[model samples]
Target: MIAAPLREKKRYGWFDAALRALLEETDAALEAGVDVPEEPGGWWHQYVCPTHGTELRFDPREREATAFRCPHGCVLEGEAYRGAWLVFKHQERARTALSAAAMYAATGEAKYAEAANAILEAYASRYPRYPVHPDAQPWMLKGRAFHQALTEAIWATTILRAFLLLRDEGALQVDAAASDVFFAMVSSSMTEYRRILIEERDEPANNYTAWLNACLACYYAVRDDRDGMETLVSARGGLRHHLEIGVLPDQLEFEGSLYYHVFVLRAYFIAAEMAERLGFDATAWTGSAGQSFRGMLEALVGLAAPNGELPALHDGPYSRPPYAREIAEVFEIGYARYGDARFAPILREAYRRADGGCGGGTGSAERRGLEAVLYGEGDWPAAEPLREPSRLYASAGFAVLRHADNPLSLLADFGPHGGSHGHDDKLNVVLMHRNGFVLPERGMVPYGSELRRRWFARTPSHNAVSVGGRTQAPHTGVCLRFDAEARRSYAWLRSEGAYAGATLDRHLWVDRDVALDWFEVRLDLEETVDYWLHFAEPLNVGGGWTACTPDAAPGEDEAYGYVATSARWTAEEPFAAVAATCGGERVTASLLAVPGGELYRIASPGTSVDPSRPLDGLLYRARGRRATFVAAFAAGDAPIRLARGDEGSVLVAPAGGGGTAMRFRMTEHGLHRE
Candidate 1:
């Protein structure tokens, strides 16, 4: 069997950076000493500020101290904060142990080995005494070191990696008895985690199950247990089963979040690497539907924006892009495994974007962390900017339309309601322009926060239509038509069950500088319909508007309760415009006024988990059995005029009065443009 690359120290850019960081972290741990709490740690999600719903600030130097402070100068104490701090300590210990093991392997230092062994022995000695957490939900599998079995699996994987490095380096030979105890404890923990996964986790395809399988695979590899490995592979919800069912035909994760897609793929990569090091043919493994790791990597490559960021769809962190090192490491592994040239540009771009593209700085140090040290091949090919065209991932339920020359792109979600992590936002649209999100999708807050369910996941928080002030029911949407050309692109989608008795259809047209939208809803009964849109910048309405009382606001239930200040206007003419200035660029939207349409400009929560930074929102409401909304969005202040055209078609042209008018007709077959 080939030795793992992590066992050898290499001379490369990323390697040097990783080694430096590891040494600093290990030295810090050595100075601070190890601290294992008698009580189990709390759930990590509970570490957020209660008032703001943001994460509490944790300084590692103050790990021994108890008081935790939020970013806004609020201090929190008691069991929740203390328990959460303990969890952070455990995580730091696991990471330090791995770093010390690697440092010992590279430098043959006795001090590093001692530090690593101390952490392992401490955990092993206390493993049996730590009680299962009391706060676990009925559906959750309780853990000893952490609140959930999922976290235990994560913590154990790091510890096992550290142990494997020490064992392979022969450092464990000095303390044979302690080594045996550690091994036994880890083996027992793996067994319990596996049992929990098989019996308790009904969804083998979940991201949590992925981590559990990774832990089991790592342990089996360490023991050279072929039978154990086979059992895990063939189990009902094991690695292979997850690949077959959890990966969609489009090769994206079934959860519909890029974050989880990369997350689950990381677990699979870890398990496969372990299997390969153990002389197992894991690289050749594929799902029944030919779902290979290469396909998954290719899907990410295609979905990445020109700047190498992905759209934060569904329940994901809206503000955070893929870490420079994280994505660089992913593509490094991809290039090594598949030798795909397409992976090269992404790697180069990630590195270039790291720390403001500075050659030597903290950013560069971060970009050159553990993944790059272990997987990267030193030099990367030069990056050529991506000239990506529009794409449609049909099976995964997403469509992207891009302008040829600029960074303007539109993403439409008309796919399966992602299970539990999914939001009530089918047929929602997000617009990305000039390297920023103009029409943003407020991804989600922490699951522990009530705002996650109350505001972030509701239909009104997204750029979609809601019925009678209620969130849309979970439903899948289908793409009716998609056509792309050099000058124009068009897509239409239909959702029948987003509302119980209504069917929603949305059509979009994209050109060099503008996007046109036509949304129509047919209902069984007369009900109020609201077309919702949220902007990244404050919106300023022009022409025919007046102040209104708070009672005149849209719906007050569901997410609407969060809407603070509002203004209302009745459009007497056929056209109304609202505009916002973003990064010195003007973004304008022109709407075709309905007979009794009431337009509103309001301040609401933006794409941030923090409620303090609110964004501008536009709500267009009309009451009828059938409602239609037509609008045009552009980068500059060219207001668009809309009117009825020949044969019930819609006519749209720049209100500035120079461009030729375009006609759009929607039919059962598709949308036609002339």
Candidate 2:
């Protein structure tokens, strides 16, 4: 039986030569991008210009140029060159070399072999001299060619693959010294990364830790460092710690970002796959928390929408369907390794996404080449995509309520707002109907931007409870209960730290029986607070009072946060409820009478919006303390009706037999469930 690349004899290693041949034919081989003219020709690179960490395409019409320029005529300025783009270029050179070597192997062509040897020799000669990127972090390995350890580790895996590809083709045989130097560079990189990773073994880990372990695993395999592999495999709180803290029990990425989750998963997947390829057992290695590598991928497949988009949560932007070409190679490879029949249908969906250029690679020959072999796209028949069930991520403190039949879904975030990438939106709620937002979460801006600091990440920008005219305080949440039983889904999250002296309990109840969904927020406060509900657009109507949604309201400043810019209750609310057209949807909300309860139409606080533009928002001021606000909203154009009871509770019924009449009462003592 043919051994994996790492186990093969280095002296005569054309590892996976058949795959290389396929890649060469399709220009997806490691050396596929390398160009050699049939006749000696002038440098083709003369027509191209590189700038701003991006490549500019020339018109190719101009024969001669003073300096290379893109069609936009922009001169390229070199930034610190330690990014993924630069790393991709380096890999391009390596792949090009490997492709040429593969051609020589197949056809015994001397020129191809020489071309391949030249690339390896050039890199090996200069390998020791390429300085650490000026922008590299202090902890980054000084002599490593890549700026980031993660990038360096990735380079190690790909470069080694390139080396193995050409070893059997007599290229490495012709120059034993260069071959030793090339592997020496690999050894140096592995040693540095392993040292740094082990040094910081106890730090609260992130995706970086997962990647570090992956790199170490791959390195151990290549170097035949069994002891090193054992050290890593047995390292306490190393990869195990990352899994324990970073991934929830149900396989949710604890950081709450789909992008980062995928990023971390891919690295671990590569490592585990590499380990198995080297005849090691790593897949079943669960973390300290009993979390296995397989569990992460198991739950990830359902996250994609019907069109293959991972739902945008945390830092990932809301992508429309076919989200960036969903890559299913992980699943594809998973199926191959585990021989699990379930992955076949999902694999088909992933292949469909790859065909759309989101995954598998449209322009990358290396990625496309491997994908063709690894994915086995057509080997599996297509099946219906799996729909993610309504789940409450209790450990991570995120609650999602998705309906059985409709696209109406609500994401309630009570989780740790994740460090750096986190928002101050504790107990915040985002609702979607038919994939269109009924209540939208604040759109994300660039990380660490001034606007992000001041507004976008603030609690006021979210659908949350504000107390004492300040944002919600930092807090951890306990999901008291989560049940998706028969007709409805019920979840209650209690947060004691939301306010310094108050306890906040938010309940999301979805009753599919009556086709109604609503939120019940009860704050046991020591001080008076305000409930801020920001809508996507201006409202057109208010029951028991006049609703204002002018093109531009006078005296009201535009705001991105829910903080009131300028708001006044025009007249005493002698009526029980208010109804209005909230942006694209309709909403009718009535307060359960409290001693100090008062309601008014307000505007969202944002620096970006013009004051002349209408900002649709709602504010309910709980006069004294201990305020309970009950709000019911239907996703689409469902109007509402409210009738106040004789005592204080308001009976809420939608225009068409509102599913359930939810009652919430607030007294000086506390909230009373009616």
Candidate 3:
């Protein structure tokens, strides 16, 4: 029953492989004295399923006579179990094959060896060949197209491990016919994949499809096929383009959400592994796929809060957050490949941070919830999550603190740009550091017209200039042109004397600028000056939200609000309000209003209120009016300034006497004729 030995190694031995490594761990556990039933008539065992938490039974006694039964049918075997299939999938089969082989060699059990051969034979017979298509072809209805490619690659690599173990055990089953057929299938698949990818290599967005191409290279290299390796190496152009377009230092997703970023990084990491195995370094092609992997992990760490939850995005699962368990997996891979030990501490800290966190107690913890995984060890045994906090988002805020490299001087804006995964949020900045904690985008994940309005066109979702006091027309259920909300005519992140500048052009109507220097997060906004403003109104001598400020003690600047009013007039001018909502139930808001057919407006402070109104608390707007206002905040103790300066140095006080002044130029519309 011993499998045939196959392939030669370059620098690594068969024992160093992933499958072999896991097997070694299991073997060590067994040797540490977990009672194992002897071969042939070995006894079965029962335990709770690790994934579904259902009762499970497994018989290691019989090679082909093992049985497993669970009430949920979340057994380790069978096609009817999607949940089970996802858990102990093809990857597990590969690992199990090596483990069985190693156990057989150590115990000299015909049963273990037979078990190894059976698994190998079963996979070979089932897949036989890897598919070349990116997805299931139109006619291939029974199974997925990409599944065959990914699964077969797993089978081939693991079978190679099986053969290697068999050879070392001196139980070589060298069936020349079988070996040739397997090799031919792998080699032919590589050829087919390479040709298809090459023909469509011009398209950059189709980068994920290259994962199959990389796997194809691995299979070919295992067969010592050089031509196929060359083809695989040549197919990296499109992938490189995809990674670059995803993010830039200056222009980022408004909200610091990184859902799609994970998939892109994974694609590159898998390719790098393939490149390394084939005697080719992918650093040049990938421009440090390893570093990119590190960057992503670091970002995840930064994204984690003290309590271990990532910032809440529209759809959570598309991009998973990090904790000890995930960090361990990343570090293990990094340690194996790059020989970097720095990742060790990061992993250890992630575990420490996630061990004891508060949970929602809905017991939905294992539903692939990103928040659960962020602050706590989640369901993984190797983790130690932090103590759970009361609110998940607050916990998420704490989780992000764990990864803050520059907690004091850094800035993070919660702006989801381009509406990835149908989350329509832009210009919303969640700035951290010593100024104000500004939560740009308010709540309401799904309360709009269509899918487009729900995603890309909701007013509460964006932090940009609004006209007629409304969000731009909804995204028309399309990617490229979502009603052209914010054309982003020009945007640049520049280093000022002490801070940086974030400015944008929303066509001709608005010129929005955010200056981040020392001690303040200043926003200089110039709107069309024609629409109705709800919050701050009636242009005054100074930019002062007077009605809301005198009695309140500014605690922490976390969030803010902007609205236009048509119902009342403090000094005979329509107004818009900008209020800063802090963590300590103190809300400091200002009302700035522009009158009908007036270019200049007056500003007064809106009344400070309790934190009962969550930033997701309410949506208050005028019934019928057109206005634009912005809400920006930062972390730390710096002042949050919302000043309107003109061409001259005359600072007209909004409240007639004690308003702050801007040292720059200015312009004036009309006087406050109240």
Candidate 4:
């Protein structure tokens, strides 16, 4: 039997610090006690503030309170909110049981063991009686304790870890008969979980499958069932198959969402750690194409922004406080497993930005968590600052161009359409400064929100061109050329199927101070196309703009209907400028003239859930079978001039005509800059 590491005392300062933190949390849990709701939980996503369209707040400490409150002054009571409270209770019970079990192993405290046993026994007794969630979709695998099998898998994995720790410490030896009963019930539920995952939701290349596999691996390891383990590894949609197919060649999770990427990584990491404890070679396992967990870690490290947060591409939250803390814990585990030095900067930054700390020590060591206590090294790695260069992940379909000293960076998405969770915004781009996003992707909203389909997931929410006011069709984009130099980086991408019988091409050039964008579209039939740019901060458009509503508000049936305010401009000059202030820094964009193009300034919902908060946007519309547009963007007071050049080329130069001029042209080969 594998002995729990926390059972033995260690002389490491980091370990002690992390242990102190865990014990504090465990003490709090013990005081609060466990509350197992008699009714099963509903979909957590449904617990949204109906008025504000944001998640409702529930105080875990107030276990009996049923009226959920939103961050705004809205209060909601009833089935969905109450059911969501039950979900919270179930989650807290599982987490508290784990903390208690760890404390019992570390300190041999009977009180901790009793607390853990009480929660586990309560769950075991009630597991068979809870009905499958009523709100679950017909195609989805339902759960007894939670709404979906995915969430049930997550709960079971945590609970089993607690159970295994207690079992290994011989805490359960006192009453073997009761322990046996608990194991039989929980293990039977796990078997049903495995059956549903394998027989019903047979998605080999999905994050859901990874969680299902983790739960099954934990169960088999606890039972010491070698045959079951082997079967899980060898089955068609099992662990090995998921690992091989779900992780793309570029090492990103196939979903193309940074949040889901980390989510899937956490599940696999847990499974690998459990397998290693069972004396298996799972940690050393490699996929068919030689992909390994180490490669995936490297991919994450490569994708970290200068602030160490991953971009909220596709369907994920922007890396902020609580989420950043969770990401730090994941990085701590990765550093322990691989000893990679690149993770140090991200770990340090994440901890520094985390909302609260354990008050244990200064610097990175201050914010240690359970992972750090269990697996971290004694001496913390130096938090060396990163000076990343512009690069492209061809397989993953992302190109990042970083300006010197990290003042400006642009991420261009030109790869495969992320399955299901992907936004229909091909050739979408997100621009950022050292502080935050300039043109941001609204990432995603809760799955239960109508706005998720009506606005956030649509093409208008991103920085891309929409044809016929319709979202782009699901399609992969191809990078035509990518080049990085000492002062400039350039990329050209093409998508043929974003619209049927049409071709879309984009050229992006980033210099030390300015970015030039050229977008071209050719359709077999005449159609109206609109180029969109959304700003995180409010924007001011200049050059004789007048308030006016168009024939329709852009797209009445589409995401454009969310536009609450509008203004129009028919430029007298060949160029128009729009500017925004971010963190007291002025950023400006200069648009080159399009023949007969109509420019509109609009305000739309700023975030996925909050419609009351508005974001500024610029929409340039043209009606034709073919269209081309050029624009230049820069920080501060740089005057940028964009104009048509000789031989189908575009010219970007200083407005006063003194600075170095750059000429760009698209050829049959690729984009060329001179």
lDDT of 2 by residue, 375-413 (tens): 332234344434456777666667776556544556677
**What C-alpha lDDT, on a 0 to 100 scale, does residue 672 get in candidate 1?**
74
Error of 3 at 473 (Å): 7.3
TM-score of 3: 0.46
Q: Estimate each model's TM-score.
A: 0.89, 0.67, 0.46, 0.89
Clashes of 4: 0
Once model 3 is optimally superposed onto the true structure by TM-score, how far is the C-alpha of residue 494 displaced, in angstroms?
Answer: 14
**Tens-digit lDDT track of model 3 for 1-674:** 12122112112232223234334444443332212112111101112333332334332322232335643565455322332233233444555566666666545677557666666565444444433433333432112112334334434544565655665677655454666676567656644544454455543333334444545545554566666666556544333433444433322222234433443444455555555656766655523222245555555544433223333333222111222334444444444444543333444443333332211111111211111111112122333333211111111111111112222211222232334343333222333222213332222221111222332234333333333323433222111111111311111121111111212221111011212211111223322211212221122222422333321211111111222221222344333333333332222223333223222222211211111122221122221223333222222233234444453222222222234533322112211111
Worst 10 residues of 2 by lDDT: 36-45
lDDT of 4 by residue, 96-121 (tens): 88777877777778988988888877
Report the number of backbone clashes for model 3.
Answer: 101
- Clashes (backbone N, CA, C under 3 Å), per candidate, total 0, 17, 101, 0
In model 4, where do residues sit more than 4 Å from their true spots?
1-31, 103-114, 167-186, 189-202, 319-326, 348-366, 369-385, 403-406, 484-487, 540-544, 548-553, 569-573, 581-586, 609-611, 637-639, 654-658
* Model 1 lDDT per residue over 1-674, tens place: 11355545465455666667667757876677765656778777677776876667655555475788876788888887787788777877887787787788777788888888788778877776777778766767677788887778778878877878888888853355655565566567657766666677555677887887888888887778888888777787776888888898888899888767877887788778767666677767788777878888888766665545555688876643234545665677887777776776666556654534421122332335445545666455455545567888898898888768644667899998888878888989987765456787766665777788898888988999998888999889999888878988888989998888999999988887568888999999999999988887787797688877655655745688877546877657767888887555888888888778788877776564455567788888899999989888877766667787888688888647678888888777766776
Off by over 4 Å in 3: 1-118, 129-194, 197-201, 235-260, 286-423, 431-674
- Among all windows of 10 consecutive residues in model 4, the one with the lowest summed lDDT is 356-365
Model 3's alpha-carbon lDDT is 0.33
